[model samples]
Target: MEILLAIIVGVLYTAGVYMLLRRSIVKFIIGIIFMSNATNLLVFLSAGLVQGNPAFVNATTVDTSHLADPTPQALVLTAIVIGLGMVVFILALKYKYFEITGTDDLDQLKQTDEHS
Candidate 1:
């Protein structure tokens, strides 16, 4: 299962990077989303896969060998929130840029870049 997930992560990363390299603003946004999802999946896999195990123990003397680690789960949750904020911020920027420039082409933006 881990191997399959790892392969999936690799594929997502590849696709994200490919999209990121495109000249379209929409593709870039999608790439960012894909990359964030890939990172979340990675964090999840790093937390290890346990079956039929409790996440937390109530007793002070309880054994923790079979319990799933909560840190990675928490980290992934936090990362997801942060990623959402980043995507929203980027989308806002893209919207404003489009409103001003009337184009979403990276090549056109580069012409402005050279002028500046």
Candidate 2:
């Protein structure tokens, strides 16, 4: 399962980079989303998967060695919230840019910059 997840993470990262290299603004946003998800998965994978091991311990619990780490989970959750905010901001910017420029192609942005 770990191997599969690692492969998936690699694929997602590759796809994200490929999308980022595209000229379309929409594709760039997709790339950002892909990368964010990949990062979350990578963090989760690094923490190691422990089946039947709870993160929280109770009075009846005698062994703490098999307990799962919660730090990565918290970090991933925080990252998800931040990534969501970033995506929303970027979407708003894309909308405004499209409204004014009437184009989503990044290459057009170069021409505008050159003129300025």
Candidate 3:
């Protein structure tokens, strides 16, 4: 399962970078999403997968060796929220840019920069 997940993470990272290289703003946003998800998965994988192990401990004397680490989970959750906010903000910027420039192609933006 870890091997499969590692392969998936590699594929996602590749796709994200490919999308990032595209000239369209939409593709760029997708790349960002892909990268974010891949990063979260990578973090989770690093923490090790413990089956049937809960993060909570009911007793102080109980064996805690097999319990799942909560730090990675919390980090992933925070990253998700941050990634969502970034995506939303980027979309809003795209909308306003499209409204004024009538184009989503980043190459077209180069012309505007030259004019200024």
lDDT (tens digit, per residue) of candidate 2 on 4-114: 999999999999999999999999999999999999999988989877787898899898888888888888899899999999999999999999989989888776467
- Candidate 1's C-alpha runs over 4 A off are 59-61
C-alpha RMSD for every candidate: 2.0, 1.5, 1.8
Q: How much is the lDDT of residue 21 in candidate 3? A: 94
The model with the greater TM-score, 1 or 2, is 2
TM-score of predicted model 1? 0.88
Error of 1 at 90 (Å): 0.4
Question: Against the true structure, whose lDDT is highest?
Answer: 2
lDDT of 1 at 9: 91
Error of 3 at 52 (Å): 1.7
Best by TM-score: 2
Candidates sorted by TM-score, best first: 2, 3, 1
Residue 90, model 1, lDDT: 99
RMSD (Cα, Å) of model 1: 2.0
What TM-score does each of the candidates earn? 0.88, 0.92, 0.90
